[model samples]
Target: MKCYLVPCVAGFIAFNENLDIVDYELFPRRSIISKLLEFEKGLTAEEEKIIKRLLKDYGKISIESVHRWKYGKFKGVILESPNIGGEYLRENLREILKEIGFIKDGEFQEIIYEIHMGMTIKRLEESFREQDKLIIQAVSTLDDLDESIGKFVERIREWYSIYFPELESVKDHEHYVKLITEHPRREDIIKLKKLPRESMGAELEEEDIEIIREFARAIRSLQLLRKSIEGYIESKMGYLAPNLRDVAGTTLGAKLIAHAGSMKKLALLPSSTIQVMGAEKALFRHLRRGSKPPKHGLIYQHPLVRGSNWRVRGKIARVLASKISLAVRKDVFTGEYDPNIKEDLYKRVSIIREKPKKKGKKRR
Candidate 1:
């Protein structure tokens, strides 16, 4: 019934009726990624030899989760505690921990045995959620990044409309930005690319074009940054939810996880609910105004649904949702990769598309 807390580079402390400081340090001034790698790489034999005695005293890492421990593991998590103060979870323990490291004249047991020790978990839920949060944040960042990039590009397009409106018609953001960066001047730009010279736009001075090029180069950097962020999100998503990633694709699967708040929640959802995850507005309308409910939410972005003819769109959404529901369950519950789900999902979408639409009833 006591609160268990981990204090390290970053950790969590749940608030319950009882709060107790767990006596130990997981890692000192190190990140979760490094710590994980360290375990995989393992300590040098010399280092291991030194910690052998310390390891003898320290049991496995046990996360003293106040909420989950009270009710049951994974069942009654009242509320998630944020990462404990980054600087230090417990300030007073600093002196004690520092002293504990120093063993004077074989008195290591005296210092170690004095404190009540319990667990040896590599880290806690923070490590798991750190990756989840990283993925979620990367996915979320794309929205703001997209808007900023779009606004910048749009402004550039309009501004450069004076120099060359035809350039904007290229519709390739990267290429367009590259052209601007490489040859900002009207005459130079004309010389470099075989692009059309047809524009009724006014020409700009070299000074003006240089300023525009500076902005274009900055925007291009952001475009590259956007691509990198997307790659990171995909990598994290694939690791965290391979089945979901395979079936739903990275961005959409991350969206579903974000909407559901977690993979656990998404796994628990019914296929019907998963189908309408982002349609809160339409769902409200269906309840409040007797309007037609949405057939798909964000998942409508899937090619199977978006590319389908109108007749089969809803069917595709339904089948896709069912597969996603299954995929997520396996991802959360089993943590195993099921290649068949991806194959079967696309197959089902194809079958659904080929099925002939039923005739509409003729009413008087």
Candidate 2:
């Protein structure tokens, strides 16, 4: 008698070629969904017990691919080919299962609904556990804050230049804002910063100084917000992807994750893809127009890549991308920090830096 073992949401069922139930094992009512999920992943202990019990009576049995993991030790166990007896069992097993009181009129539908809900909740919980989503948002907010601060600083410079044009010499936006906010009068600024008292710009009314000071205060607030977002990104990257953070700094690592959509997606990408992730437009232009391919993308922001000689940046970018790939994989899979990744990366970069520059032919 050829017997087949079929797994159901309720439990495991063994039957003969004629669809006669030879033996069965039903899980507890409360654990039906949990057991079903475990069974989907692999053969569970409950399944092994039932299979062992049936093996005592049945000389030969066929099992599905999911159960093949444990098939090596079991004698007389055959792996059922695709769409063979298993399909027939699946088609007719519902009726047989209902007849045997394993499930009632509406119980099967309920089990399926519960399983769907359970899996959906599981996926949602996993997503929540991963901080990539938070990192993406933080990076985006940081970018927006940067743009806002830039525009506001430009406006402040223009407005303040009307009163104290000498202040325009201060290139740092934060210092410029501070100078105006603390001392709204041109005389006060010149005396405090030790500048000449010559006046090329018009003297503003107290009202105008107040207005510029308020504008500068708003820009200062934005700068503070930008710093806070940067700190948030650093904390999140340290916790979620310490290896990536170590390989790439906090801001660059967060940008990579944001551009890749998520850490899981980034971890799966090839080194080449990761290297050009933020330069999709340039890559597409190269493919479409036969232009020279880009040597690097967002990773160009990294000191190791950016500070290198232009001629060798491509090689360094390639090496950096490869190390980043390994780092991200370890971050996602093992969650253990390996210090060698950073050390090896620096070693390779130094070797590339030491290579002699190629000599060019003299012009005739």
Candidate 3:
């Protein structure tokens, strides 16, 4: 009752509690209560945890004060005065106020009223005109914002196309979308300053800005680290030269060895065998040297060592020698069968030699 209907205004006249109607103050209890509580400007992690725990335990605990933390809400005080009287009182007050004005009387009274009312009517009409102008300006500003946003999106698409040329078709949209999500351009723009101008010109297009903007929404996403990608590409290029040389060498070796016999013969032949048999070192050296070396060394790499039982390794070497000799003579070892050589060998053997001569007579 003291807070609600106490003669606070009259108290200044009766009691000298340093009070006067001239100095009457509105001592807001709510403000005082809020001040009494330990309020802080910012929350520490511990405080945040406490708040979250309270919220979790209580289901939902609203601190009406904290609603201002959002983008548009925090602008002003939200003093929630109750609407118990409803809107009826406000409408009645407006109608009564409207009726208190001068009436539209006849002749002299009307003329006098018009003379007085002209300026007020003109002022109100001018206010409405100003409102209309403001509305138009607002619409123009909104249109500009929309156009800017559209251009930003177009630029992002164009930039994406430039960077990832493989996505020229609709089929590549999935890959392009993935790339945009993975490496957005908006976050990248800031990091772009770190990259060389030439590199940016070579890679980024207008579309990247939109992509980056979209990616930038993820606060933790590092769209700005454009140099990292460049560094990776540059690093990869450094090893490309040596890898290409190795690939070429391996391919040439395969072709040459395949024409000679098969990979098995090539593997068994040693470098020592190739060298002793005078095989072309240029054709096999790149493969033989360094980490791989020659698996099969010198002997069996020669073709003549096939029948030699000096030792398994020695026979291999002899075969290698024959191959090398054949390669030198005909550029490749044909190992073609000759009937004359077979007949001569049969003639030399006692049992088979006689049978072949008798068979030859029967054929004649």
Candidate 4:
């Protein structure tokens, strides 16, 4: 007397304990994609309506599904059943559709292919709409820019030092580049910066100064581009993951997302994994050699962990990672900005900092 529900792309099919078709509900042909999307997320309104109709006749029913979401929805109304009929239904699905006039005899495979293609396209569009991918690209580009700028700045310093060694003391790369581009002549730079008139470095030809000035201009453009990308990441992080931004800071949060491949993937990671995200090599070494495990990873970039005393840094990293985990989940699921996460993280970090340092035993 028990009835089992088997969900399919075409619709929901009911079969008796003997695997005989007892009741069924078919989705509208045009709405199958939408209904299937809803089903993938959980149960759909169509499913509820059909289940209610069946319950009126059968009193109670059973669902043979592996999806936990189904169990959550039907807890009180339906008995959770073993998947006894699932295999039979899957194997015989094409024939069942043909018998029920859902598809013509020759078109079952063709129709199924079309439905799958539609679902794939719909899912792809949804993935493209998310902004996390933009953040990943921006952060990756920013890191590349930082590396390239560092190398170029060093080269510029060395090359320009040949003509005006004193400018090397400027220290700041942007200011150094500005001086070279704006006042390529060593005498002009000395006059502008109020340095001594006597020059120990070699004098460069006008042609040589022009080339160095051109190179400095290019470096300046790159610096500007790097700044623009950083600004983009800050704004995107504020919009997409405010809680994660507040907890981890914009650049670190974006790096975490890039390392995980997506915000959703980052959100799925447990606190332990998040703590050691960028230290994969160290983790593997520990696993293979039984050496001391790393105390922190990319989370070490957080000021709380980096500035804490070595004795309590590991503890602070753990607390920070836990808060990051909560922040990520809230950002991904609730999208609500909760300031308490930041407050609680700082409070716990302060408590760890206050503990007295343990004195080590003196060597004999």
Clash pairs (backbone) in predicted model 4: none
The candidate maximizing lDDT is 4
Judged by lDDT against the true structure, how good is candidate 3? Answer: 0.32
* Each prediction's RMSD to truth: 15.8, 21.7, 35.6, 20.9
Q: Where is model 4 more than 4 Å wrong at Cα?
A: 1-127, 360-364
As for TM-score, the candidate ahead, 2 or 3, is 2
RMSD of 1: 15.8
Residue range 235-270, candidate 1, lDDT tens digits: 888788999989899889998988888788888999
Model 1 ranges off by over 4 Å: 1-130, 196-199, 361-364
TM-score of each: 0.63, 0.64, 0.15, 0.64
Q: lDDT, candidate 1, residue 224?
A: 76
TM-score of 3: 0.15
lDDT of each: 0.65, 0.81, 0.32, 0.84
- lDDT per residue as tens, model 4, 68-175: 656565533554545656666887887888877799855764576568556644653465567898888778777877898899899989898898888877988899
Q: Cα deviation in Å at residue 55, candidate 4?
A: 73
List where candidate 3 sits over 4 angstroms from the true fold: 1-130, 166-364
Q: Show where candidate 2 strays beyond 4 Å.
A: 1-129, 359-364
Clashing pairs in 2: none
Mind giving the per-residue lDDT tens digits that candidate 3 earns over 236-347?
Answer: 2223212211211222222334333433353355534443432445436755664433223323332233233333434344333333333322212332322343233223
lDDT of 2 by residue, 260-304 (tens): 989999999999998887888999999999999988999999999
Clash totals in order: 7, 0, 41, 0
